[model samples]
Target: MIFKYRKGDELIEQTVVKPYDSVFGGQFDSWNVGKKLSNLTTCSNFFVDIISPSSPDDAPPLATLHFPVYTDQNAHCHVDYLRQFFKIADFCTSGDACKEKIWSTSYPDPKSDIFVGYDEDTQTLI
Candidate 1:
């Protein structure tokens, strides 16, 4: 789904796909409908929430990425933020453990890599 936020207007655009389980509720077997008006751009600052039916006790975790259009430094900052947000430690120094196995195997000298770290006490990504 896509939503755009705009100035002055309070509504936002929203699109939903069918044949998928509804996160809110109700058995929507057919294509449902809804609408709103807003001025937000395609790529703008916004918040998103994703939920699952199985666990209802806690709010779902969220990941956000912000990229500036005109600066390489900003781009690098976003990348590094993502790396740190995912709790990846020392991607530059780590060897095979930091590389994505599927990507490394599929591509010829792929430039990007991924790493995952966990908090032992909570068994969650830190």
Candidate 2:
């Protein structure tokens, strides 16, 4: 989710990052699900874990980007911290990859170019 581009951790590339993000493992899922009111504020965690440069395949992640898995304002801070990395390992998208491809948001951000609020009413995401 974090990119080297100007946008920082907030990824805007819908194509380059879309097709390559997701996983389904019972073991991994349980551990990553996080705890309630614990350090793991989210019920579920989704992020790209970054490994050290020139490091081995099994090295722990140096940083990560939990861009889309925050429960509240506090978790938002954690997401931001992890989004400032320069390098990352494999993928971790939970279900983001299936979002836009399946359907679009009828109520997009007002600042976004694709905004389709209630006032528009003319077009629904399809």
Candidate 3:
């Protein structure tokens, strides 16, 4: 999963290599589906919960990402906020024993490296 933030006028993008099983429940599917929207000029934002994606007994859990776009502006805002929160937690906490695995986004794959659009309506990534 790729998360974006605003860095001045440019879009700063990051990638969550491991699936966020605890949050979003359907992360893998989201990422797969996102592959289509990844190249789009715009994307949508939605809510995501933060929790450990792996455990001692259940390590590297799988999840499918599902983003439901609402017509209501308030709902969009709320989900966007939650998504931002999850992005932060994932980046700062990802580790062998952590909940998420976020990275600086390496090259090779256009979806995550350059095309990086997943679910942000404004698309103001930085």
Candidate 4:
């Protein structure tokens, strides 16, 4: 994916590669060994091109198997939430500076910490 960030008026682009499997039903995608090897070789070559000539250190060894384990549902959920939060943060912080404003008129001050009744069952943030 190409991520574009603005420095003053100029835009800088960065490319990030996310390796994943093609067969998994859930978020943890599986990749074939051959395909993984190919991707690693390509990445190593790219790194070689970018590193300075003085730093002739060879590319770090690549892992043979790529597997991310989410131990529990809560861990998986938190990861998904963080991904969404970053997207929202990017939009909020990009370009011009913006201020936070509360829209609800029902509460005297929506921005202030006012106690609202919570449900014991769900333990939700209200």
Candidate 5:
């Protein structure tokens, strides 16, 4: 299926290899895999592309690291890990600019502790 979140953005047509599945993510999801029955998962081929930080957005990824995606034993993917991974990238979780660095930059006034170590629950550094 072809999907693109924004207009004027490139469209990505992904073949449904696993037909029915969702990117449930390993962390921050409403569901838990800690259960003995829930822990059961099947392996699927997944990958992340690493690109040079200096490279342009249009540039091809430098390396593709294939990772294992776990699904339920029932041939249905309960969660999508890639979504979880990318969503994490959309925010900041740091303390000191001179200390903590991410792909990692200090944004919006250069580390005024803006979203430092983003505590979503309390929304505070503490």
Candidate 6:
């Protein structure tokens, strides 16, 4: 998996080969892994890039799962960015939406305090 952070034109990408099981209780799935990455207390511009083995070519990301870690205010800039990238409906959950969807959607763990934005282009959420 590739972990990334972007602001304006500056994009920092990191290739993670080993899993930090001790830090995140060994959760390896995308959602849980994303949750762990989202907990970087000082980070607000975090994103997970799932590299497709079949398509190693550099193309625009078709899907994105945004984890916004704003404690004071539940706001994220990636929503508009993903909207323009995927050309899909914006699905955002915050505060209450976070609490409800986590359980209803069978998320591995609850995400009550974070803001989540899912790409609708891949039709994953539907």
lDDT of 4 by residue, 27-120 (tens): 3322233432332311111111122223335642232222232223335345554554345423334223323322323324544554675667
Q: Write the per-residue lDDT of candidate 6 for residues 1-126, one digit (tens) a residue.
A: 444444223554444435556865763543343544344434355455655444556765545555444432333544544554466433446665654553444344534433454557864432
Q: Candidate 5, residue 63: CA error in Å?
A: 0.6
Write down the RMSD of candidate 3 (Cα, Å).
Answer: 21.3
In the range 1-126, model 1's lDDT, one tens digit per residue, is 222222223333333333445676654322122222132223233333322334454644232223222233235456544554466533333445536443344333523331355668878654
Residue-by-residue lDDT tens digits, candidate 3, 7-47 = 23343333454665686565642223334333433335433
Candidate 1, residue 87: how far the Cα is off, in Å: 1.5
User: Which residue pairs in candidate 5 have backbone atoms (N, alpha carbon, C) closer than 3 angstroms, thus clashing?
Assistant: 22-80, 23-79, 23-80, 24-79, 24-80, 94-117
Candidate 2 vs 3: which has more lDDT: 2
lDDT of each: 0.36, 0.41, 0.40, 0.33, 0.42, 0.47
The TM-scores of all predictions, comma-separated, are 0.25, 0.20, 0.16, 0.15, 0.24, 0.29
Model 3 compared with the native: what TM-score? 0.16
- Could you tell me the TM-score of candidate 5? 0.24
In candidate 1, position 67 carries an lDDT of 27
TM-score of 2: 0.20
Top lDDT prediction, candidate number = 6
Between prediction 2 and prediction 4, the one with superior lDDT is 2
The local lDDT score (0 to 100) that residue 3 gets in candidate 4 is 26
Model 5: per-residue Cα lDDT over 1-126, one tens digit each = 111111123221222122234574332112222452355454344444444556777877666545333545634553465554445534445556524444554533445646557687987763
Q: CA lDDT of 43 in candidate 1? A: 29
Best by TM-score: 6
- Per-candidate clashes come to 5, 0, 18, 3, 6, 0
